[model samples]
Target: MIAIDNILVSDDVVREQFVCDLAKCKGGCCEDGDAGAPLEKGELDEINAIYDIVKPYLTPAGIKEIETRGRYQYDREFGWVTPTIEGKMCAYGYRDEKGVIKCGIEQAYYDGKTSWKKPISCHLYPIKISMTKEGEVVNYEPRETMCRPGCIQGKKLKVPVYVFLKEALIRKYGEDFYGVLEQVAGSYFAKAEKQNK
Candidate 1:
């Protein structure tokens, strides 16, 4: 436990860099190609709204499958991407002309139209949040997952995520929402480790 704490604390302190060469491969994180990513609250709303709009365009059975699927899970403790629909890539995942997996929502945002309404986890790529038990945030940290090139990198190099979450509250939501999210992230982090182990 002490070692885990130390690694977590120290890793959160120093930023790490990994440049993804998407040209070398199709989007590794696309659908079954890689683990999914965590979704943010606003993202959920955006996706659901898109679903309502797009469902009419899909086959009846396809719409049924989506509606019958279980409620999407959101782990608040440790940040983890939500599960993707079976037999499909991420709802917002797409391939560019060069066959790179591009984010639908991001493109939408860039085009000045209704974006895919993607999760914050997707928006704040390479950067993650962390929190502590007493309801205090730890800091923000740089995550090393490979992503498309030209993504934004931040200074403060790395900070404790939970700590940063708390800090972000003033800029976004109030304490009550962030407090609950901290617990969710903590739980998700634990679950991810157990699975990997």
Candidate 2:
């Protein structure tokens, strides 16, 4: 584990490789999970506030789910999460012509309707975060079956999990923390190189 500021990050973030192969996965993480997209405390209010602007991008089913259940729901195991449509894809999700699910809120953001792109948890996927008495722990757990193609693609492209998640890391921890993480990754890989030689 490497501690930067109040965060303890797993080394696998640098050791392992991953990049979302959307063609293969079809954004399955948004649809396949038992729970909806995890939400931060403030994200709930943000979603509610921006509902009018984002609603246009959503499907009729998504709109009905949001209207009936509200923006987010509480799951005993997962805390607060975005409500799902028929307990499948997230209420904020929509499918493209290719039948791949995508985030409507992000689509709105891309269209310049709102500044908030999407939930942080959705953005920080492949990296799960947990709060401890000591600090926040950022971990990488390879997904079973679903993420295999992404792993293969990442290996082919030579992208480390940390490198792929640069934007989310910076969003979550700030530039200073990410800079320190880069330093740690540099030293860690250099040491590994020496040990191998």
Q: How do all models score by TM-score?
A: 0.46, 0.97
Model 2 regions more than 4 Å off: none
C-alpha root-mean-square deviation, candidate 2: 1.0
Candidate 2 overall lDDT versus native: 0.90
Tens digits of per-residue lDDT for model 1, 26-108 = 56455543435665555556666665544433344444544675224444553445445464566446667797776655566
lDDT of 2 by residue, 61-146 (tens): 99999899888999998899999988899999999999788999999999999999899998888899988899899999767898
TM-score winner among the candidates? 2
What stretches of model 1 exceed 4 Å from their correct place? 1-21, 30-35, 52-71, 74-88, 115-117, 134-197
